[model samples]
Target chain A: GAGVSQTPSNKVTEKGKYVELRCDPISGHTALYWYRQSLGQGPEFLIYFQGTGAADDSGLPNDRFFAVRPEGSVSTLKIQRTERGDSAVYLCASSPTSFPQYFGPGTRLTVL
Target chain B: GIQVEQSPPDLILQEGANSTLRCNFSDSVNNLQWFHQNPWGQLINLFYIPSGTKQNGRLSATTVATERYSLLYISSSQTTDSGVYFCAVPRGSRLTFGEGTQLTVNP
Candidate 1:
């Protein structure tokens, strides 16, 4: 009955640095998704994984953003050479298939 | 990409009052969901009604898929209900969310 969980609830880093946000989905969930939310705005899709493979990653802003879920239950969103503009709350969600996504407490990333 | 629009960008209500939030999409969707983001910045799933109606306690949602709209009704709301309510529909394989309606419930 555990909901999704994210590590390092808050992270602060300098510009051009690298950071990784992890997500632990509910057991038996076969789909995972990543999203980013800026201040006073709705969350924007980042990437999604179905099982161990990323089913759709078009939402990833650029090549600097990459995510992986090799085992299908845990996924990590990695940012390379982070920019100040990349500062936001990174959210993760998991679902039985893709509808009714249950979200986790987002990891707020601050790029200073 | 489907466009989502929510009415009354902001709302103020007294605790124990009733209110309705609306969401309209530009295209038909097979999936529509409502979420509430609390002040602590946690996104909680409220409903996944793509059609018909569903209720959970004092909260209920109705989606008229053919009309491209959905409505969320809160009856006798509480102070804890104050937060940003969002409606999302899939755009491609990912969900596209609305600007969200910020609700303030005063006790």
Candidate 2:
């Protein structure tokens, strides 16, 4: 069975640029989550989606961060006007209803 | 928001030795999970024990919800176990993770 997977394992962008990270959840998973891991730090939650609607997004750092899962199986995390402070690894996870989450390999984003 | 704290912060163990990592939470939680992040930065789910105990191979975990703490035990450690161990709890639909315990097992 396929686990969660993220696209473009690595991404580099200049400050003030916009970038989008994609995630493909496991088959039949109805829950998707996004998190960010800074250097020497643990992963920080970002957003969560159940089905097509976002169930919780309180972890989003600021207005510049947004995510969507229109089809309920795939998700996209969008960042507006990238900042050097945003340089980190973005992780995606998926799980069945009330089950343990399975994580993806993550997409490392660098802002220069 | 809940506070999650991991003890020791770092540990160094010899292969075939046993070690235990602990995690403490500030409040009650509906979900608790343990994860292992390898040197390459890949996160692997180890256990999902909100309460009680569970074991897999050389790894075992016990969560005492009433005590607001969980312990992960690794027996007969191997060099491959060198990595970071994290404990997470759900806050709403998001997971709140601890800083993690860095483990280095030497051969």
Candidate 3:
């Protein structure tokens, strides 16, 4: 509505547990992106969606890390069998056609 | 896959001082942008410079895309400018961000 918004500002889950982070993009924005940022590092791209289909997923670290933007506005990043290394901040951003993107508050996922 | 590099990995400056940051990309890119991330982790947009130069207030940026590099200049810096500055390039429409320049402005 305002800017991009992500859910569960922080998440703590045990190893092997499953977690899902949500992202709500600005209304009518056609592009959505997911990224992971480890401490002391810049964000690494994970996946990008153009409308409801993923335009490029080559950045996803592994198959266990998956993202979906069904309907093109709201997206979800699902982690299966989470690992401790997966503990990092996940950020979501949305951009209108050819415009710079606006970021969300980010979800800090801590896998224990 | 474009490689983005930012120089002066870390910088410290006093209030009212001026500083410059740089970025070099590995390939031709259609979109380039600068972002500022506060210590609290909020990312704010700065500029989108793919070529030539542009200015906004005390902050200005220049991109020599033909040479695969960009520069960001901050004049009369303030403590409010203390944070990490990032340079990003659009790769096939997705942004690839650099490690960033950590700038600490002293009071």
Q: Which candidate model has the greater TM-score, 2 or 3?
A: 2
Show the colliding residue pairs in model 2.
Answer: none
Query: Each candidate: RMSD to true structure?
Result: 0.9, 0.9, 1.3
Cα lDDT of model 3 by residue, B26-88, tens digit: 998776999999987878889987789999999999999889999999999999999999999
Docking class of 2: medium
Candidate 2 TM-score on chain B: 0.99
Where is model 3 chain A poorest over a 10-residue stretch in terms of lDDT?
A: A96-105
TM-score for chain B considered on its own, for each of the candidates: 0.98, 0.99, 0.97
User: Which residue pairs overlap in candidate 3's backbone?
Assistant: none
Per-residue lDDT tens digits of candidate 1, residues A39-98?
A: 999999988899999989988999999999988889999999999999999999999978
The lowest-lDDT stretch of 10 consecutive residues in candidate 3 chain B is: B88-97
B40-59, model 1: which lDDT tens digit per residue? 99999999998999999999
User: How far is A24's C-alpha from truth in model 3 (Å)?
Assistant: 0.7
lDDT comparison, 1 vs 3, better candidate: 1
- State the lDDT of candidate 3 residue by residue for A23-84, as single tens digits: 99999999999988898788888898999999989989888988998787999999999999
**TM-score, ranked from best to worst:** 1, 2, 3
Q: Candidate 2 or 3, higher DockQ?
A: 2
Q: By the lDDT metric, which is better: model 2 or model 3?
A: 2
